[model samples]
Target: MRKFYSTALVGAMASAVLLTAGCGQGLLAGDTGSDEKKNEPIMLGMLIPQSGSEAAIGPYMSNAAQLAVDEINAKGGVLGRTLELKTADDACDPQSAAAGANKLVTAGIHLSIGGYCSGATLPTLPIFAKADIPMIIPAANSQDLVDQKLKNVFLINGTGAQQAGAAAAWMAKDGATKVALMHDNTSYSKDIALRTQALVDEPGGPETAILEAVTPKESDYSANITKVLAKKPDYVYWTGYFQEGGLIARQLRQAGYTGKIMVGDGSVSPKLIEIAGPEAAAGLYATMTQTPDTLKGAENWIADYKKKFGTDPGPYSNQAYDAVRLAAEAVTKAGGTDGEKLISALEAIDGFPMFSGPLKFTPEHTLSTGGFQILVVKDGAFALQDALQ
Candidate 1:
């Protein structure tokens, strides 16, 4: 169900310039000489999962990026040039992501945002690197992404290490003496799970008894549930998307294992309750990247997003918004859009207010000190359990 606004509506809402090489020669025939130069548009590509299992989160991120561009253009765009976002659907698949990356490069896009899935983003990294196009990943948090050290890639979301550290600290504070770690075997899932295990297993930290890996597409997890139950862990932390996390939570409860269950940001979606049923999802805890609705300084952004999209914003919407805004700010600071210049600008960002917090990049181009908020399922909805500062 793709919803497209009227051409007039799109133009009014966003000063979009749908310019291709030879799409409208008649419209530009009369506007010769100097006027043509003034109307030229700067293109920023967006590679998102518009069709796939992860598609639910993609459109929100893309919309957030568009919102930032619209706001930027409304108040005198970069170098007096209007910024236009050209979107390509990667479907959260590696092959598709590579194709999308190539398409954007061919379309002459210098900067881009998106790729929510790490598996998809990883394959496309070389494509962006070869083209010298800078990509600001809004939601991919796999540690391997940074470990690869691609010169043109930047991550707006905190890494798996950050999430795992916050989660381990919270669990330890909650008196979880023995914890079980479960992952879906994907790069993002396994990385966070392993990190959390290491944190909990450290000397003087809480003891971790079990580390289990499960296929994400498996429907039945009774065997795994039985194994986890046998361990008698005080808590179970699952690192995976909503699909598997919901199923594991459901089966774990069904198998009479009632430990304190927690999940990473992937399981924070409302759909988890629907998949696992409200009773099964009850008391489940999750750590998520800050959201517009949860953060104090996001009221204006939430209002504007609702006004523009006619819906509530998703969990990562603010992160995507910040990603685009930070990219634009970086481009401005660099006085140009070259890859090296933009990378330096991104690293040099300091004390900028974002939906997350006062933004400052570490030497590695990661968030300096912000942490994830812990949420628990209460009355069939995710409620804030503890605010992380």
Candidate 2:
């Protein structure tokens, strides 16, 4: 699924660097002291769920990565060497993620451009940190990822904290006096749930009716819905993935407990509509980054993706694509794939073009603007409801 190559340009550049820098201190020749073989392709690694309940998203992210790689290679490659993408299956499980991270490190990837489930992504952080590989995370936005304070980690997606704020704000604007928060207990889900609870408990915010947790992958959630309906909340928010979220949505609607139903980004998949049934899923709301269908002026890109993959681009595809381009840019700006240099180059990025907006990271290494918008499930698809301006 990957290709590598060395060109005369790369060999010449390496010879030039070695001649001028002199092999003294930590400064080396064209190899950039990164110890990579001269003229070898710059290796990029990705860890996505090739097999798991979330496997539906694997193609969206991986195919986008390949698209970026092909585009970059066609344009003279990165740093005179073509980029090669190697992937490992994280399976959206912590143990699997850890093993996959190690596999990527051992394979000698210069950078990582993947992370979908925060629960799975969390365990891989220390693994990558220990190996000194900089990560340009595409999806997984758990604040816990930032709390670790690992310099090698950089999140391109909005953080969980930002999503929580957006969710709570939307609830207020909808005139909800009481809200129920539900989570699947995954790291990503729980982070948003806890943060939203805190924000809604603040002065002038709505009353939090209940903070509920549900076991994921369960077939039934009627008991949980019963507990929630007992609270008589005017609004309900589910901060979890689509599988459980869809069932919960359908159950809530069946139980006649719907004031309004909204979900976090993880629940923005079309499968949500299928699982909940179109009627039940109708009018469903989500706090999400712009998807291919909702992004303006992206018709051509989306068409190309469809032509390539034989289907429409899904959620997180643009983010994954951006991650690849950002990785290539960092490598170019750094002059090599040295992890430390790449980190510095990424920190220095300012106003780079991205589908969400101009790209810039805060001091905390999160997007300056979360780029979350309100999306509603209408006629079995997600469309922009509010840009939150």
Candidate 3:
């Protein structure tokens, strides 16, 4: 759900070239481009999962986008014109996300924000790039997206590569000499699992005892369980979502294998506790981007957000908020809604303060490597872990 106003749209947007038209006596008044640019609204799109397996995340994403919109509007709107948003559900699936991206291009957005699941977000990149729309990815962080090298795409989240490195480092710190790397064969999960496997493996790589893949969304993982238990590895790193991850944790405990368990970024949902039960979920490590609650100087904002939204902002909500604010600020700084100008503005950002952290984008348009945080399920919630220990 989004709101738009034609009358207030882009009224204040004026290019430096256009503003000086009247100052030059030789220039014709008709050549001033303000008339052409001011009539269009500063339209932005949200390409997030409103419906799908990840539908649970829609509200949090929407709330963050709306919060940014509200704050920008209160500050006299971006570029002195009202900012508007149009949302299209990406559904966290490739085909669906592509359709949503097309819908946004058809609506003629000035820019776009939001991309959650990497599987869904990947296929939509071409659509945004082809339309010349700058995309600000608040959450999706697949290495594939980075490899694509599209100029219009920017990601505030750490890449899968960074996440994998974090996991491998934690394993080393934990003294997990014989670790088992497992994945559920999903794009997001498998990518991290494979990369982590490579990092932890010897140059020649490890045997089957250290690597495995499982079918996703299955209620029973006993078949895989039997195979894993046979190895007796000291730690199991599951690069997958919480639904299956929780079950694996429970089964590991049931099978009486007591080493340690850690999950990938996608498995950070609180529902993991429900899936595995509180007891089994306890002590399970999760490699994830820091959420608002865990970030320094976010306590009051988190409290205010909970009061306003009726729930703690979900995974990536803080980043989503920062993405929106960044887009708005960049558009204002450029003094117009031009996509190219916005791209330049985004790249110029250096440690811009956000609730999540002081955000800065690299040359590749992704966040820095140290964005990840190690979390453990302590007393049914994800709390920061002292990884050194």
Candidate 4:
């Protein structure tokens, strides 16, 4: 990550000012006395899986966000107002996410910094747009999100196209002549699967032997395995969440297919190893941006997280933290919670420090470089393997 100086530091300080300032009068609120309104907290909203197959990840994201909130509040709060976090469960479902989005909007949140699943996040775009709430999405990087072109929406996670290219390139680098791509057919998974297929089909890349979709939440996937094994692929890539991905990994190994196995960012969790069994997951690889364990120069940050939550931070935790800081920065720059002003403030950001690197959104409001790395399941934990420079 790049550190800022001079004017950049001044901009950062301004954002810190916004985070610490007492909440000012909101557009919807009554024009109460300035003194009373100034002491109110600025509400930040989040939506994540709380009671679904992806429930294990909710705390990781939410807690990190709260941690950021706590840090900012400790420093005396934004615009002189303290920051408060309000959360609703999306359960990684589209309908659930839409309802949750509406709940957050009704609650008068100034900004949004949550979205773990792309399919779940997609439907909420219009919901937030209608309410004019700016979203600094920490995860859920489906290319479809960018396609929506919602001015109020921005992503801090790497997009599917970037992950696809990283996956295909890694497979080819491993000398695989035939690669099998699989997904659960969700919008996010399918996008990565299809894009990877296209990349591998390029002139000098590996051949796409099979592109298969399996229904999620099934106990048995022998039929799908049968199809994949028939192609004799030297490499297999699974683009789905941890629940299904873990099962597929174990099943593929149990079926006696010994090819290299890799998973997408959605599947890069410690729970994947648990579900797949340590032995089955030992050689697994993942295409992902840096996670807490895999990130360099994050010891103090991780230590602080463990101290506050009494548990180790995981995937998306850093992103969630960065998202909150980014939101505060924009708020301070914009001088208030006005949607259009916040959008312009975020767009104008340059050289902001993030776990990924210097912050600058492309025209589509995505990172110019996905900053993906190759990770392997070493000793039952995902560890960095290559930077893919």
Question: Which structure is stronger by lDDT: 1 or 2?
Answer: 2
What order do you get sorting by lDDT, best first? Answer: 4, 2, 1, 3
In model 3, the Cα lDDT at residue 158 comes to 74
lDDT of 4 by residue, 35-127 (tens): 335567888999999889999899999999999888878766777788999989999999999999999999989899999998999999999
Candidate 4 wrongly placed segments (more than 4 Å): 1-11, 14-41, 50-56, 91-100, 117-120, 172-177, 184-187, 209-233, 241-259, 269-280, 387-389
Model 2: per-residue lDDT, tens digit, 63-90?
Answer: 9898888877876677568999999999
TM-score of each: 0.79, 0.77, 0.77, 0.77
What's the C-alpha lDDT at position 41 in model 3?
Answer: 57
Residue 12, candidate 2: alpha-carbon lDDT: 32
Q: Pick the candidate with the highest TM-score.
A: 1
User: Per-residue lDDT for 1-389 in model 3, tens only?
Assistant: 00111111233223322443334313423443555476455888999899979998878888878876875676566545677878889889998899999988999887889899888999988898888788999888878889999999999887888788788888877778678888988787888888887788844333225678899888888878878888888889998888899899998899888888999877888888899999999999988786776665566557767887788887788887777777876776555666776788788877555553456787899875466778999999989894321
Considering only N, C-alpha and C atoms within 3 Å, which residue pairs clash in candidate 3? none
| Model 1 Cα RMSD, 1 decimal | 8.7
Indicate the TM-score of model 3: 0.77
Top-lDDT candidate index = 4
lDDT tens digits by residue: candidate 1, 1-389: 00121232244223222221234333434543343354567678888899989888887988888898898788667645688889898999999999998999999886878778888889888888888888788888777788778867778788888899889988988889999999989887888999998899999868989999887788998988888889899899998999888898899988888779999988888899888899999999998877766665456667888999998888678788877677766655554566776777677767655655567876655677664878889999988787676
